[model samples]
Structure formats: C-alpha cells, structure tokens
Target chain A: MQDYSAHIQCSACPIRHRAVCARCDTDELSQLEQIKYYRSFQAGQTVIWAADRMEFVGSVVTGIASLTQTMEDGRRQMVGLLLPSDFVGRPGRAVAAFDVTATTDLVMCCFRKKPFEDMMLHTPHIAQRLLEMTLDELDAAREWMLLLGRKTAREKIASLLAIIARREAALQLKKAKGMLTVNLPLTREEMADYLGLTLETVSRQISALRKDGVIALEGNRHVNIPDIDRLLEEAGDDSDGGMLV
Target chain B: MQDYSAHIQCSACPIRHRAVCARCDTDELSQLEQIKYYRSFQAGQTVIWAADRMEFVGSVVTGIASLTQTMEDGRRQMVGLLLPSDFVGRPGRAVAAFDVTATTDLVMCCFRKKPFEDMMLHTPHIAQRLLEMTLDELDAAREWMLLLGRKTAREKIASLLAIIARREAALQLKKAKGMLTVNLPLTREEMADYLGLTLETVSRQISALRKDGVIALEGNRHVNIPDIDRLLEEAGDDSDGGMLV
Candidate 1:
C-alpha cells in the first residue's frame, strides 16, 4: 500500500477534471477545499459497514473499492465497483446501504457530508456534475444486471474483462486494439462475488479464455489480450470494444 | 389508454410535487408548460427500441412501462420499471439504451429533448430535482442487482411481489402492511423476464407461495397478501418492508 497522505493541492490532483468536483470553478473549488480531506485505507479494509451512518461523501483518488451485500446464508454479491475518480456515498442518504471495502490500497478525497450537501445547494455546477455521474452509474448498473441475469459463465468472465480493459484504456487515453494488457484488480473470490459465480467457475472460465486464445495469462493477476475485438465478441458486446471516439 | 391530451394545468397534476418538476416555481412551471405535450400508448406498445434515437424526455402520467434488453437468441431481461411519476429518457444522451415498452395502457407528459435540456440548464431547481431523482433510481437499480444475482427462484418471486406492493402502497400514501392487494402490471412472461427465471418456474413459485399461505391470488394479475410480514420474510428482505419513514 502506497502512502499518498502528503498534502497535495487540489489543482495538482490527477483526477481533478474527472471526479465529482470536475465542474467546480476556482471559487467553488476553494469552498470545497475548506471542507475536504483525504483518507487512506489498506487493502482488504472495510471502509464503511452496511446500514451504518456515513459521515462523508467522496471520490476515489486511487485504487479500487467495492460495494457488496451479504445474504443471511453467507452468500455475497458485489453491486458496485468504484475505480479512480468514481464517486462514493449517497448525498441525501445518511446511512450506507452496502458494505464498502478497499480492494486495493485506497485513497479518497472526501467532504464532510453536511458541508458538502450545503455546498451542493449553493453550487449548480457541483449539483449538475453529480447528476450526470449518477446517471452514468445507473446505466452501468443496468448493464451489469443483464450480465448477472442472463449471461453464461464464459460470457460473464469475458464481459468483466472487457469492462476493466475499457476503463483502463480510458484512463490511459488510448484506443484498445490488437493487443492490450490489463491487471486483474480483484482476486478469484472477489471476481466470483461480482459475477455471481463460484471461485472454481471463475478460474475455469479464465483458463478457458486463455486456452481459446481470447486472452493470455502472464501471471495470476495479469492478462494480455491478443485481439480485443475477439474478446468483445465472446463477451456479447459490440465489437468496437467500447472505443472512445 | 387515457387521452390525458386534454391539457391539464401543471398546477393540478397529480405528480406535481413528486416528478422532475417537483421543485419548479409557478414561473418555472410555465416554462415547462410551454414545451410540454401529452402522449399515450396502448398496452404492450413499444415506446422506444434499444439504440434508437429518442426525440423527447417525459414523465409517466399513468400506468406502467418497462425498459428491457433482448439478446440475439431471444432471451430478455427487464432492467427498469416505470410507474406513475417516473421520469423516462436520458437527458444528455441522444440514444435510448434499452427498449421501453408499455406494460399497461400508459399516459405520459413529454417535453421535446432540445427544449427540455435548455430548460434544465436555466432552471437550477429542475436540474437539482432531476439529480435527486436519478440518485434514487441508482439506489433502486443496485437493490435490483442484489435480487437478480443472489436470490433463489422463490425468493426472487417474493421479492418482486414485495417491491410492487411497496410501490403501490407508496403511491396511495400508505405503508404496506396487513391485508395488501396489488395489481401486477406485468404479465407472467414479463415477470419471468424481470426475475431471470423461466416462465414455468415463475408460475410454480407463485403457486408454491399461494399453497404456503404467503400470498393468495384474486386473479392472474391481482395478489392478496394476508400477512405482509410473512411475504417479506419469504422475500428475505428487511421485515419493515421498505417503509420510507
């Protein structure tokens, strides 16, 4: 886990233009600065427990976290994955609805809930940006629901890889094409929770994809795509591979 | 379908305080009125096909509509259900991502896309309210994901019943409890799609619940819950059954 706690100016933040505060002007940014602080969590740490009152709202500054639900019988499902620049916490709701855990060493830029809510009331840019981000998250959730409800095990694994690759490509500002390499952020167990499969199934599917040449495994945590379009086809998504135009 | 095309003033609208225009002042309402129109669809009518261009955004004024996705092999999944006062259409995006179909004869209050986007920009209240509504929808989507990924066939059916009953109760300003009757807006086939089950499985589960006295059938579409708590228990949800307060 990298320690990034050294006070960095908001202007110098890597996710300045992509986070919840993306639309804020200098004055609005200063207002946010007064109420904002950074917090870090080690990998495997629980950030917030389900049904507990949340004291702040924030955006992921680095690393990954997941929102998950646990059943009475000990079954679990991952509902949302927060990557760099993804927003965390509901603005109006005080209680967290799912348990949030840091999947990797994580850093977050957080705003005290009440002050942030007050700032949103006075800043149209912040409110509008948050709205756009929420809509995007809703769309992503619906897409994941389709995968959970209908996709085959192989398709589910393929879809998860494609999603992660697309996000990684976006972060690098590069079009995914002939060959791409991605680091699997979650473990086999975590992947099982996200895809509604068992760890054994996840391992089998990965081995299948590798044997079929859709992907090449460099190590347990690394994947190399020989052909991005082929992988997308297996995923049952558009062959364009979600290229940003 | 109701011909609500007979120009009802926004001031008298049943959802005036609940829809996207919830925060609008009299002057803001007049601005919305200038660009608004009414449209109605018959039961089973397709409102918009997935990936098609959408020309307008609207609020459901009556009846039920659903957003669904169909795979190449004919497997379908219902991603969203829109009841009275639910907003439809993405504001910033030009294309519809899901096929929206009317499950019952439906009425909607619509605004031309360009005009509605313009109105959203100038009316901070409208934008703010839309943000709030979108957030609520995101939460609902996450909850649905949990049901889709982690529940058993029986639990899924019971959960669906609980959700519909809760929504119906909320519409009437009452909490779901005691003897509660709900008119299911979707057909058995549609219910199967929403629950990610075969139609036969859905039917069998419904019959099993009836036999177990968790619910009683008035007709194919009408369900009477003698004890709402028992139904919730079967649903594997919080015993309070999603009471707002």
Candidate 2:
C-alpha cells in the first residue's frame, strides 16, 4: 500500500535509522531499493498460505502479524508474532512453511525473493543481522514451548500478561508504576490459542489473577498490573527475571 | 565421568573422520587436538543447570541428550532432543539458559566456551555450518510448538511416532516398506513430557491407537505402522505432507 521502492530512501523512514540496514551505505541501500517492494493486509486477512510458494521475503514496517501452522482438521497454533522491525520469511527456502496472517492493519517492507537471496550472498551484514534475529526468535519460541508444555493455566495467563506488559512497556519506552495499564491487543480466543487453553480458561484465569491482586481490569482488553513483581510471581518466575516468566 | 580435560587429545578419536573439524588439514587438526576434550555422562544425569555459568559447549558424539526448561513448581518441558552430531551452546552468550541432560549413556566432543567462541570467529566455515544447523533446529522447534499448542493427545502421539519413524528411516538410508517398524526410544512419562500430556493420557492414547488399528504395539517401546499414510492421517497432517502436522 505504501510505495517505498523508488530509491534508497532512508531519509524518509525512521526505521532505517536503527534497523538492520543501519550500517548500510548508499550503494548497498540503492541495491536494496532496486529489489524492495511494499505490501499491506487488512486485519484478519491471510498474507500467505501454509506451504505455498512464496515469491518474496520482508520485514514488518507497521502493524502486527502472526505465523501459524494448522492441522488438517483445522486446529491451529500461532508460532511467531511479527512486530515492527521483525523480519518475515526464510532465506534459501522456496515456499512459505506457515500461514502468515494480519493481526492488525499491516504494512510490510518487502523484497523480491530472488534478488534478496542474491544480495544476501554479497552482503555479510544482512546475513549476520538475520542470524542474530533468528537466534532471538528461537529463544522466544523455546520459552513459549515451556509455557505450552509445562505451565499451569493460571501461570500461563500471568506469563502472557507479563509478556505483553514488557513489550508494551518497551514499545512505549517506560517503566510501569503502581496501577500500570495497557490494552490487550489480542481477543480472548486469540489468547487461548497462543496459550494452549480454551477461551473460558483464559477468562477464568484472568478473573482469578484479578482476585489475587496480581492484576486488575479497567475494561475489556485493558489490564492494570498493580506491581510488576507480583505479576511475575503469579507467572511462576524466579527472582532473576530476564526469562520472560 | 571421564577426565577429558586431562586426556584432551583427538588423535585416536572416532569422530575425527566425520566432525566439524574433518575438513581441517593435519596442522589444523593438531591445533584442534590441543584444546578438544571428550566428556561422558550416565543415563538420566543432569549435564548442566538452566541458569548455571557454562564453562564449555559441545557436540554430541554418541548417544542421546535433551535440552529442557523447568518451572519453579517442578513442571518440566523437554524443548530439544539431541542426537549424535547435534550441537549445544549459544554463541556470544555465556551461561546455560536451559537444562541439558543425558537421556542415555552419552559422550560429547567439547571445547572450552571462550576458545570455541574465538574459533567460531576465525573459522567462517564453522560459523556457517553452525548457522545452518541452528536454522534447522529453529524449524523443528516451530513444528513442535504446533503439536504442543494445538494437537490432541492422540494426534500428538501419532505425530511423534511418525517423526521418529521418518528419522530412523532416513538414518538407515533406505526406502521404508509399506509397513514400517520403529523402536520407541522414549518411555511413557518421557513421551508425556514431550507431548505436553499427562502420563495417563499418553497411556490411554496408545491403547486407543492400538484398538483403532492405527498402530500395532509389539512391546512397551516398539511400534509397527501398517501404513505411514494412515499414521499421517492420524497426525492430522496436510494433504500436501508439509511437516506442520
């Protein structure tokens, strides 16, 4: 929807100042410009079919998206969440392995797959940045697996809240104080899917957490954590708190 | 435990012919020989704590191991199964983030953490290989997330069996027959942890699969599939056979 392919135009994009291309010179950015494109998806739209032939790879410029896998019987799991500055699609792979869906009105900074792969060969920084990002994703996925496989329903809900609180806090660049508040971006059903629970279970756990004073509700999709430490405790996390509960 | 640090010599090691250092010339091999060590662990031994300061990183030279995460209340999830040739350790980070354990009598090719990191910097090929391996591991982890988060207990068991069968078949380097036999390497409780189910549920599902003619049980850990396709169907796999299901 946004035409960003005209030239190597960091002057107009804030993300260019700090994203993976921060170190790129004009020549490298010009090469990227020749291959890049832009695309948009409305909320609730599927961006790519699972296992479909993918023609391009890109990063999120604005809005949220999800990487999901589904069973033949229609059961689904959300594997990766794409936020702004997050890369999408795999290099050296021809087809998309998961269905990517827009969780909000989405805009992506894209690149033609063939040219991007070729450029990756000549550009060490791009590959290096990608490796760093992939490793980070892997760590997050492993942490999620812990939640899915081992955490109690109550702990799972608290963990999710803590994660959202941390992310939203980071996005807004502030520390939460007493009665720290943020909006829940996901529906109850989406939360259930991400936490491996039913919607009822999610609702019940949220209510329980509220009763325990770990969190309070201002309105639907609005959460207030009285103390971040208490929320982390409810998440069943240790004191040395960098593990995402 | 072997005092491999004292016996740090690679001259007679079995893995020398087929390891990360296999391509190195005699001089390079000798250089590696000075720093390399072999460590062994008994079955069910904890190799490293999740939050411990790691002094070394290694590759599995023989036998089986697992990477796992545990909650404060004792809930545990096995996040990774390490077969021979599989690597362990994080680059540019010190300390273990997950517990590593030996699931069978295990031997590993190890290097001191600092030296290994330094070696990685100088040997681009080694870094390249590590990148490739980590990418594959990331893919497997994502697929496992689907099973843990979405599939029913019955489907999880079927999917796990199908995966083991496929891996065994590949290792043997032969086309599988219409009927395939597999030695189940995991106990019911271990399977339960891997599948995100209780042991009772795991046992019940195994019984149900056998009763439904979806699988034939020869013993506690051996299974026979009359048709791989049937098992795949039981796995709720896509018609196109993408590994997602």
Deviation in Å, model 2, residue A191 alpha carbon: 1.3
lDDT of 2 at A203: 94
Check candidate 1 and list the clashing pairs.
Answer: none
Candidate 2, A218-238: lDDT as tens digits: 887899888988888888865
Q: What is the TM-score of each candidate against the true structure?
A: 0.92, 0.87
Error of 2 at B115 (Å): 3.2
Q: How many clashes show up per model?
A: 0, 0
Backbone-clash count (model 2): 0
For each candidate in turn, the interface RMSD (Å) is: 1.2, 1.5
Residue A160 of model 2: what lDDT? 88
Q: Model 1 off-target regions past 4 Å?
A: A1-11, A14-16, A238-245, B1-11, B172-177, B238-245
Expressed as tens digits, the lDDT of each residue in B92-163 for candidate 1 is: 889888899999999988889998898777777777888877887877787788788889999999999987
Which clashing pairs does model 2 show?
none
Report how far residue A90 has shifted in candidate 2, in Å: 1.0
Model 2 chain A worst lDDT window (10 residues): A1-10
Candidate number achieving the greatest TM-score relative to the actual structure: 1
